[model samples]
Structures are given as structure tokens and as C-alpha cells.
Target: MKRNVLLGIAAAALLVSAPSRATQLITEEEAKLPPPKGAVEVQQRGILRGPKVEFVSPGDAASSPLRLVLKFQSYGGAKVDPNSVKVIFLRTPNVDLTPRVKPFVQADGINMQDAELPPGEYTVRVDIKDSDGRPGTAVFTLKVAPK
Candidate 1:
């Protein structure tokens, strides 16, 4: 039917816009940056409820070109501000990853297929804010095993 055709076109468009074959999320140079001198402080206030972010797949360790999925849940009836999403490589002088994954970010979360990270362990920090201005952050380490 016409609906089916339209749906197919929509899917194709999405695929075209999605990030493909991500050889590396963080470049070797960026990864070599010195560790932060001190602990990074993050504080959230005012808002009675905040958003939550979680990795839905590819646990702590996975091979290259794996599916990277993140789930976001907003609280207090607030909706996620997709544009406020920030992805950072947690190294000294944090490297900004937001631009690299911006296209895949959505109000719900991020679903990146073929995320080909180099073989190593990486600490990443994801910061996001809800429509009400409440901020949320998640820090996790991903170990990409060698092929």
C-alpha cells in the first residue's frame, strides 16, 4: 500500500543519515591526553526530578563495529532535550564527542550501529538535559576487544 511505500522511504532516509563504520570514537591523539588533574564535579539542583541514561546493549566489552544503544528516561513529566546531549571522552582536557554522534541523538536516546571503536578501554561521559533544564550524566567504560 501507499503507507508501506512511505514507511520504506522513511527507513531508507534514516539509514542514510545514520553513522556508519565508525572506525574510532576517539582518535589516538585524543586518547593520549593526560588524565584530569582533579575530580570533575557535577551538581544538579532545583529540579525535583531529572533524566536517566543507560546503555541498553554491548555491555562493558565488545568487538569493533558493534551496536551501541543508549536509553534515556525523563522524570517529573519532563522530556529529553536531544539538542542538549553532550558526549565527551573522559580524558585530560576532555574531548568533545557530541558532534560526532549528534545526528544519531534523539529525544529517547542514541542507537548507533557499526560503532567501530579501536581495541582498548575508553572512559566516556555523556551529559544531557531535560526540557525543564534538569541535567543528567552517565559515565561508563567501554572495553573494545581486539579482533
Candidate 2:
């Protein structure tokens, strides 16, 4: 009887599904927006030492449902402030993606297991501040082809 009960509990645990952390980073309509006018800035400067943002995964071009991994590295002993992270889609009006990705932001980096985006070219900008209030930024463009 004891062995049967243990096996049943294990089976039940296996059957229970865990909640998903998948986030829709960009909607279909948002992906279709026109490009930003003029030149968009792509640089980072800090007083002490700014955080370094790197697009660690999914390559420069990928299909939909991208596994986006952004790594943040701080220098001069300053830690990356999770709350100070901001994500932006550099479109005509500059769409704010910070709110959508805040839940996944951390001191070390932002990891989205499944970031859904439509098939289109995307220019993303990431801004962050260190514990000392030093600002940092990163800008990159990616192409999402149909899959």
C-alpha cells in the first residue's frame, strides 16, 4: 500500500503542468510600424562604469517565437539595476517595450524563454543604469523571417 501511494503521487506530480513564462514582446500590428525617421542613436556612456548589454542568443536573424536572452554586465563594482532596465522598439514613435519585459528583467540579465514576434525587421534599443546611476545602452537590428 505504501509503495502504491508513493507511485501515485509521483504520477500525479508529473501530470500537473507548470505555468508558462512566455511573453509576447511584439504584436503583429506593432511589428508592421514604419521605421524611425532620421538617424537613431546607438551608443552608451557612463560616469563611473556603465553596464554592458549583449544580445546573447537567437542570433541576429531568426524566426518567430524567439528565445531572447540579453545579458547585462556591470563594471567598476557597480551592479546592474533591474528596475532601471528599459526596452524600446525604435519605430516611428518609438514603442516602449519595458513594461512587457520587466517581469523577466534581473540584475544579471533578461531571459525570455519564448518571446513572440511577428515576421519583420526589428530595431531594438536597450537602456539600463547601474547601482551608481550610471547609464548604459545598446542598439541592434534583427530580421525575423517566416518559419
**What TM-score, computed on C-alpha atoms, does each candidate reach?**
0.75, 0.79
Score candidate 2 by lDDT.
0.85
Off by over 4 Å in 2: 1-21, 39-48
**Model 1 TM-score, 2 decimals:** 0.75
Which residue pairs clash in candidate 1? none
Highest lDDT: which candidate? 2
Candidate 1 per-residue C-alpha lDDT over 89-143 given as tens digits, one digit per residue, 9 for 90 to 100: 8777788988878878899999887776777877778899999998889877778
lDDT of each: 0.81, 0.85
lDDT of 2 by residue, 39-114 (tens): 4546545453678898887886788788888999999889999999999999877899999999889999998878
